[model samples]
Target: MVDHLIIFTRYPEPGRTKTRLIPALGPEGAADFQRQLTEHTLRQVRSLQQRRSLRVTWCFSGGDVAAMQGWLGSDWDYQPQAAGDLGDRLIAAMHNAFAAGATTVAFIGIDCPAIDAALLDQAFHVLEAADMVLGPADDGGYYLIGLCRPVPELFQGIDWGTAVVRQQTEAIAQSLQLSSHLLTPLNDIDRPEDLPLWDAVQRQMLSVIIPVLNEAGNIRPLMEALQQVPEIEVIVVDGGSQDGTAAIAQTLGARVLFTNSPRACQMNAGAAAAAGGILLFLHADTRLPHDFPTAVRQTLDGAHVVAGAFDLGIQGARWGLRWVEWGVKWRSHLCQMPYGDQALFLRAETFRSVGGFAELPLLEDMDMVRRLKRVGRVAIAPGRVSTSGRRWEKLGILRTTLLNQLILLAYHLGVSPNRLAAWYRDRNFSK
Candidate 1:
């Protein structure tokens, strides 16, 4: 038996979709919110599909099939919403699903951030014994409605967008003596006051962006470790690696983006492609602590903290590395300057506000930290990210330390980034 899940959404055109949120989020922002919400909802649906036998249909308004496919990919069965009120459209979709031989059908809107795979699976499970299942929303409208069979009368005589939607639907079900199950109530994002619900959801989502060049050796392990963290999006931006780094990351289920070789350019590309509200800039060879997601959220939640990074832990037994770690701790806390190896992170909005990482070949991390400090405090998380010690081990620690300080001093002395980059490369190449 085919189980069908129908998702109702708009095309997210700036002035057309999520119009109620325009005053608070502006047209473009509201559209972006709609886009994110729809994508988030689909992610849960996809997760459910992985564990169950289900088919999905995308019922949309305000866009053509090509446009919808372009935005959301062509994997779904796209259907243009029938012309009528919300109730009419619901019935039409439900009728089509049953007509197409679906044994169980569920309809949902992309307004509830709390909807997840488990909740969705439970909805289908309830239909085994119950005639109908509805996920109640705090605003009195239901976020989800599922049925074992088509019940057209249930969609009739209800105020679609009012606070009485769920009440009326339940009353209809009671009058018909139908066996129905109501799931836990959740809040939906609709009004300006509802923005906080979406914001809270965003706080839990972290996008880890790794810029790489010929890093196939490190990409696999880094990706494997990252998969353990929940609610994180991994984006690997490859700077035209010849070692099949992009292919490896893609095979590991990480989104891969190809861009120019400059680290800043690659990082910026990943950020632009990211869908999460929080962005973490990571290195290919660095491994985050097990509790990195929690650490990231807690640190960013602090008052006056606009950006943050983890403490540096180099992977080696050298006693000198302890001194290096100690130096980093003080510099990060006192000077508020933690270099990129510590794994810098901040909100996506804050990153855009600061104009993203400067596209300099040398000292881009320092430049980014300096700019972030101007807006608010840079916090150092208690957790540490262990990075490879190849750089310090390849060159003597003392020589590398001195070279780094000299480059910093030269940057402060107003040396052109191009000149600094050339000099730095020359020094590294010189045995």
Candidate 2:
């Protein structure tokens, strides 16, 4: 017999969902928090489903079925929550699950980030002996509730959002002589004070995606440096490199993917294969600081920030390169436009929502930054990503700078990226 997992969540509508956090996170931020929390919880549930015979159902409020499906894809069951208070909805969901042939049913909310596959497995295992299972929240409410069969009286006449929720439920269970199992308590993201729980979870993983072309010399060193960083997934997308770049990256423990030329295509390919929640796009020649993961997380912690990049640090002794770094710093901070070499990072959801990087021959990073600015702040992290200054040194700093400006100006003046790419290639080849 298959068990059923019903997820309780609301469609993340600004000013509607997670209203308690709006004072601190603002409407958009609160909605985004809800979005992230729901997705995080689902990831855990999906993990459990992979190893067990569990059928998943999404019972949501505040948005229609189409909207929910559109936001989260249309693969699973999506049910609009029956209209009522929390207890009434819980009763209806439990009844529906039992009526539909569920051997055991468990209900969980989206607020708890600590509910992983292991915890969920324990909940189901406990239900085999106990009539009921409840995962308590540190706030005195329960994050999860499971039942072997329908027990409507367990949810009756209980205070839904108050501290006495779990207590009252357990008291009811005791009155009915139902044996209940309590899982470990976990903190939920309900108020401003509880936001740290989500932050801690988000800092656990960072996926660095590097796009390279024939940089066998640079790939090994970059991959080695990335290997030293904890809690990171390194993906090297080689653009048909002939200099053994892909082989070197594979040997150095980086997940290497082979894609066609053009940096945009390679980065997008890496992103598609990445499993982490946070994505960092780095140039093959750029080296991130040792604590880059912390820097990335801290910068993205801002309520209104959607994407971020590190400050540029060109590795060279040339005095002109210092000026180049200075200009890049001011532009990144003031204009909120950091080029790809500076190590751009953001939530994977945000990156996908912006349609990843446009597959253009040139100016794809600038286009991405401009599109991201329309959604939220494109922040610059305090730490710097040291990048090779070979381009400037090879073509003379002043000329290269002027050429970059000219290309940007032409791009804004309706120049096609293909033509711009051709002109840029010719200029670099002639130089």
Highest TM-score among the candidates is held by which one? 1
Question: Candidate 1, residues 220-286: lDDT per residue as tens digits?
Answer: 9998787555456788999889999988787665777889968999999999988888999999999
Worst 10-residue lDDT window, candidate 2: 224-233
Candidate 2 on 363-400: residue-level lDDT in tens? 88999999999999999987898999889888899999
What local distance difference test score does each model get? 0.89, 0.86
Per lDDT, the best of the predicted structures is 1
TM-score of 1: 0.75
